[model samples]
Target: MISMRHVVFMNVAEELSFSKASQLLFISQPAISKHIQLLEEQYQTKLFERKGLHIELTTAGKLLYERLQAVKEIEHKTEFDISVLHDAIQAKGNLKLGASTTVALYILPKVLSTFHSQYQQIDISVLNRNSESVKEALLAKQINLGIIEENSKVNQIQYTPFITDKVIAVCSSKSKLLKKKNYSIQDLPHLPIALREVGSGTLAVLKRALAKHKINFAQLNVKVRLGGTEALKNFLLESDSLGFLPKISIAKELKAGELKEVFIDGLALQRQFFFIERKGETSDLNKGFIKMAKSIYNL
Candidate 1:
């Protein structure tokens, strides 16, 4: 097992604050300070220099931080490998999961249900949030694993393709644009548009697609920006404005004629969902869950 002091030091090194590290490690500030003090005393090296209210890692601290990352990676991998073998011998335990809005709503439920039925003893907890928030939760160690749209370029996270889905323009049947099967990007300026909030995976995907077409997102003429899929769906159902959403999200509504999907000529908006985790190694539960999910999803 890794030393508690080393773990605390790495957390503090990553966060650069005693308070944030404490919150992350579920320890108090004084406890965090004591652990850091112990590590520094044992090594006889200063780890951090105080800069105003901020703490900056010294050269020796940076070296130890890098070494700790490698050590933790090895430790995690060994433990996971053992767990994998143990699970193969007897599969039992709990799995904690996190997913972006689209995956939670349209993709994971059925898969999770099937996994539960097969492995009746394996408990599952799924935390739902937007992609960016899900990533943050994973980074904070609040979740063991996460599925999200590919929006991050952070080197510390690993992204593996989970599945592909499309985002389409949807509106109430009462929308003036309902009569058209295809509309140009230029025509979107005339319609009242509903959009997802900033930092949302859906919004990020949409922005990237629009940028490829040389369209400025600021010129989209949005009527409102909603916080979640449910909110955006409700607003679209009650208004004539159009909104972009994952196809899987409104499958039932579209079939029921409550919403209509619109397309743009020469513009294809497809986003790939990815399984993400902190870069380095994965545990047995993490590997198992991802493999099982992909098999179930036919990915």
Candidate 2:
């Protein structure tokens, strides 16, 4: 087991802010400093250094953070294995899940509902972020499992195909863009479009699909960039620009005639969602939660 001082240090190292760590661990800033001071005294070296307005990890701090991450992973795995060894159904533990905007908003709600119904004893927490941020959170050991729309084979992580999603171009049903009878990829550069912010899976997938036809993202007239899927969807509702969004997100809007999906010739915007994790993570709780998520989608 890791020491309390080390736990405090780890939180500080991850957050890179003493006050932030204090807030997260529900301790006062001075107490947080005391723990770090004790750790530095024990180690005979400085773990962090102050630079003007902020702090950064020293070389020794980096080493300790990396080793402690491994220790924490092992500790979590062992505890879960022992706790759930006799009865998984009644096991009490925590599952931290990280998902991108689309998965968090659309895919995981039903999955979470069903999982909670069976494993009521287990507690679950979810962090919603863009695809890239989700991957960073996994690397930081902030979450045990993640579901993202990006299919990139990032190193040190494993991806399991979860569900298939499609990105469809859309505009408000009453917009002038809908006045056109037919659309093609060639017309995209001339159209004003709203895109998701950088690091979003939807934006990444859209760029790749557009690239196949010798079209670059800069060529399109992007009117606005929104951070979340729902934000972009809602923005498109009030704007005249075209936007690409996950089919699942706008299904209700499409059916209600609030938004109209524009079909472009030879452009297929299909994408695969994946359940991702650290390559060697072996928590049964993680596996069981993933199993439940996949089962709900029948994939």
Among all candidates shown, the one with the greatest TM-score: 2
Clashes of each: 0, 0
> Can you give the TM-score per candidate against the true fold?
0.72, 0.90
- Per-residue error for 130 in candidate 2, Å, reads 1.3
RMSD of each: 4.5, 2.2
lDDT of 2 at 72: 82
lDDT of each residue in 1-299, candidate 1, tens digit only: 67999989989998999999999999899999999999999999999999998999999999998788666656655654665566653455556688988899889988888777766655578899988888888876666679999875678788888999889889998887787878898887777899998878889988888888888888888999998998999999999888999988999999999999887787778888999888865666678778888898777
Error of 2 at 131 (Å): 1.1
Model 2 lDDT per residue over 1-299, tens place: 99999999999998899999999999999999999999999999999999998999999999999999888877767766776787776777778899999999999999999888887878789999999999999988889899998747788998888889889999998789988867899999999999999999999888898898999889999888999999999999999999999999999999999999887888889888988999988478888888888777786
Candidate 1, lDDT over the whole model: 0.84
